[model samples]
Target: MASQAPSRVGKTLIALIKIGLYLFVLALVALVVAVSVAVSQLPSYQELVRRDDLGQMIRVRAADGSVIHSMGPSFGEWLSHDEIPAIMRDAMIAVEDRRFHYHPGVDPIGIARGIWVGWTRDDRVRGVSTIAQQLARNIFLTNDRSMGRKIREGILALALERRFSKEQVLELYLNRVYFGGGAYGIDAASRRFFGHSATELNAGQAAIIAGLVKAPSNYSPTADAEAARARANIVLQLMVREGAISEAQARAANPQQVEFVRTAERHNSARYFTDWVLPQLETLIDETVQPIDVWTTLDVGLQRAADEALNANAPSAQAQGALVSLDRDGAVRALVGGRDYVDSIYNRATQATRQPGSAFKLFVYLAALETGYTPTSTVVDEPVTINGWSPRNDNGRYQGPVSLRAALALSINTVAVRIAQDVGTRTVADMAQRFGITTRVDTNPSMALGTSEVRLIDLTRAYASVAQRGVAVVPYGIRRVTTADGTLLYQHRSDESRVLVAPWVAAQMTDLLQAAVMTGTGRAAQLGRPTAGKTGTTSSNKDGWFVGFSSGLTTGVWYGRDDNRALPGLAGGRAPARAFHQYMARAVANRPVENFEIEVALPDWQVEPDAESWYGAPDDYQLVDPDGNPIQPVEDGPPPPPQPREPGSATTEELNQEWLDHAIGRNRAPQAVPQERRGPPPDRGPPPRRQQQEVMPPLPGQRQSAPPVVRPTETPPPTIRPRAPGTAE
Candidate 1:
């Protein structure tokens, strides 16, 4: 019975062993079938080789091909196996798969070892993928960690080894592998780390690049230089252990210094211009599959200068400043949106809209010139009220009468309003639109004083129009775009048109503005060459601008707080003008010196008003004495001798015709002025209140004097300017 029991136990053990063997065989067969099906669904080897579809970078280049900016996915230049350094390949093989050449794509021994390690350590940290297996997974599968995925990876690996040579597989692997920081392919990885081609990689650089295959971002030189060096040391040790490199070579290569290129994030000096270019990419290039290079009109030197100028002056205003420099052709040479682009990429130059203040007076004055109003035209500068709004000079004291040129140079608010009122506000707005002021402008009287908001670029373009002799300035940055292989994508065409202002008118406007810089509020922006522009300060100094241009470059600078908070004593002639001067100094340093095209006009300092008689008041309507001082007031009853105008021949009939024609049109001819008095006529209104007031203090940067008190018996009431929050008046 004992013998029979032993035989029965043996028989049972045998039967159990047989059953386990059959089940193992069945599971193995099922795995093979599943892997075969997955492999069949995989793309063919030829299809993978021929696939050119890859996300490439959109590189923005300066005129000299220097990289200004880059966007989109990274697909750097591909390198064949032969092109890749042997040291790099050997280091990669040693660190990733020790028995790469000996194995049939999937190493059973390696898998068993990995399994044993995982079982003993209770952590599946080790991977048993050969180079072929890694290539298969990288090319044909997602990074899934399931058993099914592992089986499919192994099957694909075997298929890859069967269909392609070992060199071919390695080449494909090196070309498509990700190496962190938007770098794909060994060439990109090499260039990104060493700033050179993979073929030229040294032993240390090669080892470091090869070590990134396991963890690219974790060991990137830019992100973690210490980790990258440690990884390279490990790769060197592994190479020695696998007999891929000699011990002496590994020892020498372990401590080798690696020089890494600057990270992409560090090269963001041109972010303001590049941000402007990002939206334009869609219009320039429809497809992003292929690599594209855009040649922009940006001059990097000028861009650097602009940035430095803005940064240096930012502390004064304690606010951000934006600058845009354009060539005579309206090509944007340099653009700096704010002090620091990385801190905030709002692109204030192109996007932010703020009131231009007196800078917008350019349009009003230009309109006046177009209507036969010379720069020497004179107008009363006394306090005026229009639509219940009273506008005062910056000094709170009017100059009584000043020339149009002097009014513009002095930034006389009342004079601009009077002119706009004379030639309908609508006409001023139309003239502004003709030049590149695209922002909405209210036709109110305040619009003449730059009450409307506008973009800095648009205002800069408007100034460029005057600088370019009345040519419509369309500010553009992109010059041309082409593929990496020279496929033409886009080229800018000249769409410039003639603005409403004639050349002579624009030249006169330029001459008037030049006087502004030479002696007016923009004296701070004076360049040795002929330069012209206007200064602007919004209410409460919320926005300060210096939009001026040399014969070669037109630049507009805006200094203000992001939240529209007022800056105390911040005027366009201060920080913004200084910055404009600094930037323009550099922008035109190399260019030829060109004076503005002006017809030897009268000097800005010359002041001679037409001296003549007026309506019934007196024969002489003298405001300023021969010495240019306001005449003192007299007693109440006796009328003082009339003040004579400055030296100029005055025509009685022609001078009186204007007031009489206007009075006839309005049916309110002043009965005070004698009908027979053949002389210059006074405005229709009662005498002003006789009150002695001293000259008030000037604005931050200005000089002024008290005006002569005119007691007209028949003069129209002057219109007053409206006051808004933050207004200088």
Candidate 2:
């Protein structure tokens, strides 16, 4: 019975052994099939060899090709195997894969370790990606974590090892990996961190650059100096252990002391310009396999100056600001979108659409100049109501006859509306659009006061046309675009037909604008040289602008609250003009002083008081004196008011003082009210005994009806003082 039991046990053991053998055979067959499938699906060798996705980077450079910034993936230039520094190669191999040279793109020991860890752990904590395997994954595969992906990566790695030399494989790995700061390869990483090519890298820099292969942003010196140095130390220690460098050499490396260059993009001032230029690139090149160099018209010096000026002055206005500077040919020199690039990147200079305020009056006045109206042509600066939109003068006062130059300098909204009504709003809008203002302007009377919304760049370009003697300007940032191999894709060519035949108008307008800067609202923009500009203050002080030009360049500055809230008391004469002055003073410091060309003046160019009558002012619109008497249209200033009083009372000054107590709060003087008029007793008399009354002087152009004086007893039905032109009030 014992012998029979032993036999039975032996049979059972033999059966179990046979089952295990069959299972092992089945598993081996599945593994072989998987490997075969992965190999068959390996990416084509041509795809690997023709890798040029790294060349799709767009590099934006100044006109002289000095790099301003770069965009897209793998912006660094590619390099060959021999060009890589020995120290750099050693550092990478020591830390990333010490058996790089010995392995056939897959290390058996590393694979075993990874498999054991992955099976026992909740998450795969080990990676056996060799340099060749990494290159395969980077170039041809996604970063998906799965058994299928791993098998494919391994197969591709093996194929790469068989197809290329170890040097070529390592070179591909080094040049294809991502480094921090938008750098892709060793060449770019070197230049990015050290401001020099990979060939110029030292042992310390090479170690730091190599350490980033593990995790670029995590150990980037620009992002985290401590983590980057600690990682570099690990690379150095590995190098020492691998015998690639002596212990003393590793200890003396001092990776922490590496002078990391500031590779952060410096497109602060040019952000708006670059953003505008990027879209324009599509017009020049549809597709390319290499980095395209875009030569832009940006002057870094001028850009720096503009940024500094805007930064220093913008905060004072409690608003964002945009400034665009263009050369005489409409080449954009500098553009600042807001106060700071870090706070916001909305590109206010190019993308923002805001009311230009009275700056648009330049177009209206320019249109008038085109139509035989000289700088001295008279226009009535009087109260005007158009379709329930009453525009008043800034001070709620009117001048019977103001020269076109003086009206513009004062930004008189009524005079601008009257002129637009006379010359036709469409004519002014057409002139504005013809000069480069692409914004749609309505033919409403308010459009004459800059109710139309336009971008700062487009408006500045329009002013550039005026500065350039009526030559139309297409404001452009890109000077030329070329491939890395210098194949020309686009180049700027000037066109002469853009010049207006009425060139004399620009010359005359320039004189008028110069008067504005020299003795008017833009006095803050004066540079002691011949300059011309206009100041614009919108309703509620929401937008303030100064668009001005020197013979060398024209600049437009806009200051406004981003939320459209009013910046009370802020005007173009204040912050905007100051910023313009500061920027222009520095921009043209080195250029030879120049002046606007003078066109021969006509006999009627001198201001005439009655000239405004030719514009068909309403017959009911009568000029009135401060005393509420009808005024004659005299060529000179209005005559002194008639003072009537009892004989031997007092001087005019004493009578004014005595009348202050009895003056009417509104309506008119008690005496000026006709005896036949019907109304309550005018409060022109002093308040009873202890009560003192105060009153404001009557507006010169306010028409009198009946006396309605305000007193302590009543509000006098609320006197309605007309709103100042362009004021929300």
Candidate 3:
């Protein structure tokens, strides 16, 4: 019986051996088929290396030539084996594949260890990909985890090893692997994260980059810096254990010292600006261009300021604010489209159009000045029905028979409507268009009160024209576009600006606007400099605006709810003006103080009956002397003798008459009149006794002085007038 049992056992063992052998052969056949198919479909090594299918990469740079954003795969200069730092290579090899130098394309030891650990731990299998295998998968295959994909990856890795040396394989792997933040290759990753070249990377920086190969987004420093640093520490430990780096060296490599080129917050803040400029690239460059660099007019510092101010000063949690800043030449310096770009990408500054309210009064008053109405011209602020629609003052009270300067300073809706009725709303619309308001303007009388919807960018550009002294302004962002190889594709050219408004008319409008900021609703926008701007508030407080210029920078701010719901008490003088002040305070901190060119003299009439002048008491106003100092008070005594008037010198009344005659097409030829006539009369002497007595009053301890003399050659600085009590918009 024992002999029979032995024989049966031997037979069962042979049968088991035969079944095992057959299964092994069947698996071998399947692997062969998969490898053969993968080989047949594999691209040539040259094709994989060329990477011709990569998407067009766009790098947007600020005016200061710093990279602000990148779209699509970002690749840096191709680095050779010797060009790559030894620390980077060692870190990569130690963490990615310890036996990379001694193993074939497939690492049996790594695979076996990974399988045993995964089985014993009851977890998902750990990655056992060698550098060559990773390179093959990245360049030529998908990241599928099926057995078929594994066989193909192995075959492709073996083929790559056969075609290239170990050094070449490592170089290709390091140069072609993906890092986070749209970056590919070690060079791009280094420059993107460290703002430098790959050759300058230290051990910690190298380790940080090396750890990204397993999962790019999961360990991105910009996204989750703590996790990234932790992964980097693991890489350093691996390098130390691999004998590639000493323990002390690993300890010396601090991941905290690695500073990113840009903070995550700054990057997100600039995204709005970049997104606005990106779509313009297709029109600026040829469609066939593969990769290009766009140089924009964005000032990073000003952009930061704008973002901070808008976010910090937004009136309400539900409201959104937009800011647009431009240089005198109309180059966009800073733009913030919305409160938070991530929550919503709707760019309120450039895309959203809202009612400008009284801010639209600029066009109405500018049209009036062009038609010969001086700042001191009388305009009655009375209740009047126009087509059954009555436009009342914002404060529900009107100053009867107010001067144009006072009317605008107080933002009186009735006076603006009266002036618009006389000047014609079509003329007002045309004047606005001529000054760079691209939006459609209504011809209705309510347009005088800014009922017409307009974009913040267009409104801001119009103000820039005034700042530029009547020169047309075309707001532009892209300064230049170039190919990756530095071939110029597009360069912005400053075309000869056509005069839209007469320089003298612009100066007069500026004078009125300066008064508005000094003693009116815009008093909150004071910058301790010669600033001129206007305040606007739509009905029900749905929209608020402050648009002004100082130090050659023109900025506009808009605040409102995106849903167009009314904010109970919001006004342009409150949130929007404060934001404008905050941003311009930082933007023009280093700029030299510049005075507005006031060619025409302010009227002798009191701008506001009860309000004091910016400098002092209403009757104590004095002009700056030839040396730019305020005229000092003299002891009570006889006034100085009046100086003789110069030849061709005319009184304020004569200049107004001439302007009216020119507007009405009188016999005098328009071109025959000199442009100098539009300015103050040739710095003539003081006015006559009657005019002096009416315009100037004696100080408490001194006698009366001559009326303020404005030299035609010297531009006068704007005054920071006090806000009148009981005045609100």
Candidate 4:
């Protein structure tokens, strides 16, 4: 019986031992899997922790070409502990970990004590960390304090202490920490927090800073004060327990003396400007290296002027709006993305896809002129509907049988819509597309009333083509980018190649736009200098836009909310226009006060007949004297015809009257004519036409319908232009 009992006990022991072995193997496998997943899930070190480099955009003065925004080496003027005061170091120790000097990085004894208190005594002191441990976490680990990461962090912390001395580690940690409000490093923190050198610190201020180290957000001066005070008191007690301070001394410390960075001025109205400028760098680099300097073209003085003007002008009796200022080549000089970017980062200028209102009439008029329709071509500005879309003028009343110039100047939506139908929205959109307008425009007849959504960037860029008289320079923010070591990374140069449209067509559009600003809704955007621009008010007063160009500067403004909520009393002619004028007036003050360079791009006509005369180009044209002397064509073919007129219509009377001044006899003015619409691509299913006649525009970048009127080749072209600066081009 005794022998049997001994064997039974041994069997039981063997079974329990096998079970323990199985559990250990399962735990090890689980740990390996978790480690693999964590490492894989982490972002690249360059993007998260080990990243030291951020490109600093360098802003240069347009006149002097001096770099401004930020100097190279964004870690500018950082100091070591020798340069930092001993009091500052002591303060950090006081707030963070009093035993920092006495212990290695791991502090296992403290951790053991923490476990006892947390598990047995039910106290929350489970985080038995030293300053080095905190630094290790900050520089390497994430804020997540999971058990697995904590184990890894301990291993890493021990390795770090072995590699670096206490002082070296402290210096790195101090120099790399962030203290709210976009500030990094102790030097910036001190300057921002105390408004003084790190060498100058009182006990109370030191205590306040020390308190912030525990839980930065919790003890942040920006958050709650009572919580910060309570945390600071806890840190004070720790200092006393560590013998670094007497109880009396700890009691003497109060947070009241911790004066915050005395100025809230750093985050001033420039947030919107910076937000707009930052995104222009996506294609500027291949891989992240040292900090790259991006020299911007913003004039800070002009930026401030623009911001001040917008706020004062927007509330005009009862309106809210936004503003943007740009250089002549379309480099945004200054922008109020919204009243405040934090209020909303959706930049109204670049992101808002709002209806352009009657401001779209500029494109209609330009299309007419490009197709040989003159400013004197008359149209009735009556209430009109196409399909089911009805459009009206700015005021409900329409002026009948008016010249193109009069209809555009008065911003008659019905007249513009009629003209768009005649010339085709495709034609106007094509002209606009050639001028750098990337928005997908609508082909509906209401498109003439600006039913299509347009971004301020595209609108301003398009307008710049008119100012350039033919060539449009695409708007760019960063002009040049260079590495921290002064190696050139990328540089942007303005391309002046003409994409489409003749210089004459640009001139005509400019002339019409000039008329709009000089005696229309855009009058508010008029700078005292020679300028041309247009004003746009969207539905329900949701967006107010003003875009214009001086002889040397072009700018645009739009005001709206991120929620797509209507802004009360907002209109293109009110605050947005006023801000436009304010920014341009100051922006161009330093520019040369000369008119924009303008010239007609005429195609050299030819009259040469091909072999067999199967197709001799009939485009041969010649210059003739008013007395009827013929000038030979550049290429020989056919004789110039007598002035041609549109078929019977009231527009003929206005056309002949305007052309009479330029022609000797039998003169005819250009008239707007309708273009055919191209249907959908072959093999694609067409939905019910009754459900949809034409597709509305998608988002900003998608393609819809191509503009009908293609660009003209070089030839004997007539030039049109906005006469002066105040002209509503």
In candidate 3, how many Å is residue 357 off? 0.9
Clashing pairs in 3: none
> TM-score for all predictions?
0.78, 0.76, 0.69, 0.66
Tens-digit lDDT string for candidate 4 (1-729): 889998999999999999998988897787556545544554442343333643342433332345344432224345676876665677677666656777767776788888888988776656687766776676667878688777777655565556567886676666666555344566655565667765576666666666676566777666765666677677667777777778788777766544565445533555555566556566666635556666676667776787777776774333434566556676777766555544555566666676677666667777777554555555555554344345555577866567666676767775665566656678877866666667787665556667667777778777776787757667777767676467887777887754445565676677777777888778887776677788877777767777888866778777655566677777788877888877677777777766544334333211111111212233445545477776432345553454557688322222223344344454443332111111111223221221222222221222334222212111212112111111111
The Cα local distance difference test for each model comes to 0.76, 0.75, 0.78, 0.61
Candidate 2 clash total?
A: 2
Name the top TM-score candidate.
1
> lDDT by residue for model 3 over 1-729, one digit each (tens)?
879999999999999999999999998787667556666776665665554456678889999999888878889888888999999999999989989999878898988998988988986567788898998888877888888877778887876776678998998888888898888889989988898999999999999999998889999887887788889999999999999999899889988777777745643667878878888877877845367889999999999899989988888899899999999877899999998888888899999999898888899888877655677666555565544455567778856667889988999887776667666678899998887787888776567788778999999988888877778888889999988879999999876447777666788889998999999989999999999999988878899899999999999999999999988778999899999999999999999999999675433322221112212344655644334555445566664555567788832222233444443445465456533223222234222211221221221222234222211111211111211111124
Model 3: residues with Cα > 4 Å off, grouped in runs: 1-54, 102-129, 145-159, 190-208, 222-262, 266-268, 287-291, 311-318, 342-344, 600-729
Report the Cα lDDT for candidate 4. Answer: 0.61
Select the stronger candidate by TM-score from 1 and 2.
1
Error of 1 at 269 (Å): 3.2
